[model samples]
Target: MSAPGKSIFFMDLARNAGWCEGRVGERPIYGSERLAPEGSDSPAVFAGLLRFIGGRLQAFKPNLFIYEAPRDPRHMGGQTNLAAIRMLIGLPAVAEATAYACGVLDIREAEAASIRSFLLPPRPKGSGRRKEGELKSDVFKQIVSLGYEPKNTDESDAIAGWLYACSILDGRVGAAATPLFSQT
Candidate 1:
């Protein structure tokens, strides 16, 4: 494959919008605050997330962008989550961001991947989530094949989309090899 020229920016915003504190390597890390507060949806909080992401991207100036596809709520396991519902409503914004970045940088969707694989990465071999090995391997191949891994889901997916777009631009992974779902 030709050397991937553009840089990919990957980012992910969890559906849960609260300051989650978790230990990573014995160090605590704090996540964003919950968008909704005390049984009510705060437009302020929601807009904050959008602004945070949009502002960050604008500052970083990535060549390509990708977003995780939202899930169908009815398909959710009987969970009536307001935040999840809210994310679905905002899906267009995500796509619009992609278009804007493309127009600004003259790049296209290079690739796409499930948020799970991008954010979680893959389970270590002979460890957890072995089934993910194949999918992870596939994404790795696509990432390395295309050429960059933008650390966050937002950036990674966007960058991957851009690389995928580049692949299309260069004609490597065709409509057949780059199917919506690869073989398990």
Candidate 2:
């Protein structure tokens, strides 16, 4: 980590066909469209993503890297959803590739729910759902709130995750705060 404000990178692995990775620093950067290759999570795909991730790390030189992990199907109210399928199917390769990257302890995992919780406004009175917004919409708003307009959904998710990790690292979201992820 660098000083009290570590530069951060957040990767939201493919929820469909490709993944999205974002870098945050003095100036936010998101060159995520090329991070994922065709054929999903094949070994060759992983190899390509590795080089891409490494190159981005070298270019941005972030002090910390955080990625979204696949959701636990058991926690999805026992219903199989497309999001879970894409995550379980497409992300091991991404995680493995990232873990094998630079020697520095720059990588970590931040659950999507955790990031949302940290960024979401309090639940509206008498309503379980967010007042009048979609999660992605709010996340995008937060990215804008942080002063960056994300280029894509993956980039948006990454930015949200980066903010969540920043809150934890910067002391806004502490140990008493809702945990960032469940036990594996």
Candidate 3:
């Protein structure tokens, strides 16, 4: 594993067909779009997004790809439900295609679920929700030298993955500040 370039390429996908704003701490980063065309769940749309990301990734030839995993497709239905099924179903295919197209690895969190845990806290017993935000605070503290809050959870998670990869590349994790958000 190698450190991904400083220029990271990130994309988020929701199961429904609408865009949503994301926040990394307090900063807002917007770029959520449905891969599929209107009223369609075509594979081409997912393939196209992967191609677009692949093109953007060419500049740095990023060693990593941080993508948002999709929600369960069955739950995505109706006007109120904005999740895009193509985003979920098409991600694995897109990741494989993108990695082949770019010649660099696309690290999907779902493939190795524990690989992403460097940035998340353990889920509490009997609680279905994972403490990702709590883990984010821990990571920020650990990477104080980086000196910036990610623009959203995706960004935060991506940064954590990057840091974890960096540690693997460099053979050590750099010292980080204890995040102010941490409970003393």
Candidate 4:
């Protein structure tokens, strides 16, 4: 279990774009690039994601992992982040986290919906959601408020997810608290 205010690792996984955030006693360390293959492409794919996960795990060795895991699809032939999800599920570090995830309490998404709510941008009257540019700006602004300048949507989402997870860990976002890996 995490001691109060302990640092944690956060991941925001998407289609081909993903970001990992690490906050150690309040320091910003973010990543989007993957580990490169030494010679060939055989291990490149899994290495891309797995290596990132592993590197973070090895470096931080966090006590808890607050990950916005890939959303599983309900329908057949639907686009899902199965590849990334599968790799994450099988990682030794992740398995370790799962075994002792009680302290995690909750996980938050940095996807469009979460970003929209977390960073309520000034939308047009009768607007549905913030557009790409607006979201980027809004997300950037929110991260900046948190004392970090986000370079892209992926980075913003990762940082936003981290912030939400911190709130959950700190008992700030009440009631909506559910188990980790939930899309609700």
Which candidate tops lDDT?
A: 2
State, as a TM-score between 0 and 1, how close model 4 is to the true structure: 0.59
* Tens digits of lDDT, candidate 4, 41-150: 42354446564666566666565576564434453256556654454444334423442433443333334465346444356788676665877677666666656666
Report the lDDT of model 3 for residue 131. 62
Weakest lDDT window of 10 consecutive positions for candidate 3: 15-24
- Report how far residue 32 has shifted in candidate 3, in Å: 7.2
After TM-score superposition, what is the CA distance of residue 117 in candidate 4 from its true location, in Å?
A: 1.7
List of clashing residue pairs for candidate 4: none
lDDT of 2 by residue, 75-147 (tens): 7687886755654755655654564565436677777777787765666698767542488787776666555
lDDT score for candidate 2 against the true structure: 0.60
CA lDDT of each prediction against the hidden true structure? 0.42, 0.60, 0.46, 0.53
Off by over 4 Å in 4: 1-4, 14-25, 35-43, 71-112, 121-125, 172-184
For residue 73, what is the lDDT in candidate 3?
55
Q: Rank the models by lDDT, top first.
A: 2, 4, 3, 1
Q: In model 1, what lDDT does residue 92 have?
A: 38
- In candidate 1, which residue ranges exceed 4 Å CA deviation? 1-4, 15-42, 81-83, 91-184
- TM-score of each predicted structure versus truth: 0.42, 0.68, 0.49, 0.59
lDDT by residue for model 1 over 132-161, one digit each (tens)? 355545554554343343333233333343
